[model samples]
Target: MITPTSDRGTKQVHDGQDFVEFTRTFRAPAEDVWAAVTDPGRLARWIGSWRGDPADGEVWFRMLFEGDEIPEEHMAIHQCDAPHRLRVTSTSPSEEGPQVWDFRIDLVEANGVTTLTFAQSVPDAQLAEGVGPGWQYYLDRLMLAETGADPADIDFDDYYPALKEHYRELFA
Candidate 1:
C-alpha cells in the first residue's frame, strides 16, 4: 500500500501558478514503460483512453471510471518524442468555467531502471486536494497493469474521497 502522504510533490510554476508533479519507477525497460504509457490499450487499463487522430493535430481523451460510462474531451498534442516526452494542452468545462490545463510526461532510464515523471498545472489550487491522490491511484493502476495484474481489481474509492484529506493537507 502506498502512503497517501508520499509519492507526490507540489510546486509553483511561472508567476506562481501551482502545479503537482508525480514520479514512479518501473522495474521494466524504458521501451516497455513507454508502450504502457502511450499505447491506447494499455492506457485504458490505467487512466483514460484516446480516440482522435494525432496527425490531425488533436485527439479525443476519455476519462474511464469504474464503469462503462466515461467523460471525454479534446486535447492537442503540442509535442511528442516517442517513449520519452510528451506535452499536451486541453480545455474542459468546469464549474469555474472552461479550464485549460497543461500536462507533461517524461520517461528516463539509467542502470536498468525506468522512471516515469508526470507534471500538470492545477487549474484551481483547491482542486489539488483531489488531483494529487487521483493521479497517484492512476499511476498505481499503471503499475498493476504492467505487472499483469487485473484492472478489475482496482477500486476508485481507494483514491478519491477516501484519500482526499491526505492530499488536502499537502495543499494546505
Candidate 2:
C-alpha cells in the first residue's frame, strides 16, 4: 500500500506475507555503494548510529529507526561481506512474536554502473506494509549522501506516520 512519492516505484509481494523489496540503481561504483551501506562510519552518515564492528556472528548496534533514540534491543547483524552483501535480523519487542526480519543487501556491477538491491523480508503483514516506504525514504537519502550532497533535512519522527498513510492510500 505504499503511495508513490516522486515517481519512486514500489512493489508488494506474497499478499503482504513476504517482506517488501526496494531496488534502486545508484550512479556510484559498486565498491562505494557497498562501503556506504556496510561501513559503520559511512552507514551512520546516511542511516543512523551504528555500534560494534560488522562481521559474521557479531552483534552490531541496533539501528535507531527514524524517531526512536534508543536502538531496539531486538536487532542484530547476521552476516556481512564487503562491497557485496549484508544480512540483518530484526524483531519486534512489542509483541510476543518470533518473527525475524531478514534484510539482504546485494550489489551488482555492470558496465561501470552499480545497482544496489535492498530486500527486506519480514514475516508479519503489518510490518511489511509499514516498512516499505520507510526503506524507500532512507535509501533515497543514502543515495544522495553518497554523492557528496546534503539531502533535505528529514525529521525521523514523521517518517512512520507519513509512510503508513502513503502505503494505505497506494495499496488500499
Candidate 3:
C-alpha cells in the first residue's frame, strides 16, 4: 500500500504528441533535493543506479529499471546548473531504432517549498506513455529517500501498467 505523505506532490501531463512533460513539487529545499538528484551517491538511493559526474558535457551510466544487474548505455548531460536545472540526452533501445529521450528538470522554490518539474521529449508515443508512472514512482521515492526513509516499501507494478493505459486513453 502506498501511503501518501503530507508533503506529497502531483504530476501533470503537459504534452501528448511526441513527448511527455511532468511537473512535481517537493517539500525539501532546492539545494538538498538537487544534490539528491545530481549526486551519484544520493541518486542511487532513489533513482536507478548511476555512475560518473553530473556535470555539463559529461556522459553517465544508467542501469535498467528492474535492477542494477543490467547496465544501459550512456546518458549525456547537455546542460545543468548546480541546484536549479538540468538537461540530458539519452537513447532507449528498442525493436526499432533507438529512440532519443531528452529530459529537462527545473527546480523552483516558493514560500519555502520546492517544486521540481521534469519535462521529457521521447521519440515515440509508446515510450512516452510508459515513462509517466515510471517517473511518478521514482519521484515519490526521491521525496521519501531525501527524508531518511526507505522508499522501496511501495509496490509500483500495478501503478505502472495503469498509468500507461491511462496515458493511452487520455491521448488517444
Model 1 agreement with the true structure over 66-148: per-residue lDDT tens digits: 45654477788998888888888877766777778888889999987999998778756477877877787787778778888
Which pairs of residues clash in candidate 2, taking residues 3 or more apart in a chain or in different chains? 1-167, 1-171
Cα-based lDDT at residue 64, candidate 3 = 38
Off by over 4 Å in 3: 3-17, 53-56
Segments of candidate 1 deviating more than 4 angstroms: 1-6, 12-16, 66-69
Q: What is the C-alpha lDDT of each candidate?
A: 0.76, 0.64, 0.67
Write down the TM-score for model 2: 0.73
lDDT of 2 at 14: 36
Candidate 3 has its poorest 10 consecutive residues by lDDT at: 4-13
Residue ranges of candidate 2 with Cα displaced over 4 Å: 1-17, 73-79, 95-99, 154-172
Tens digit of lDDT per residue, candidate 2, span 25-89?
Answer: 87778898888877677877777655554443645454544556643544576667767877777
Candidate 3 local lDDT, 46-78, one digit each (tens): 776566655547565564357655547568887
Q: Name the Cα RMSD for model 2.
A: 4.5
Clashes of each: 0, 2, 0
TM-score of each: 0.84, 0.73, 0.80
By TM-score, is 1 or 2 better?
Answer: 1
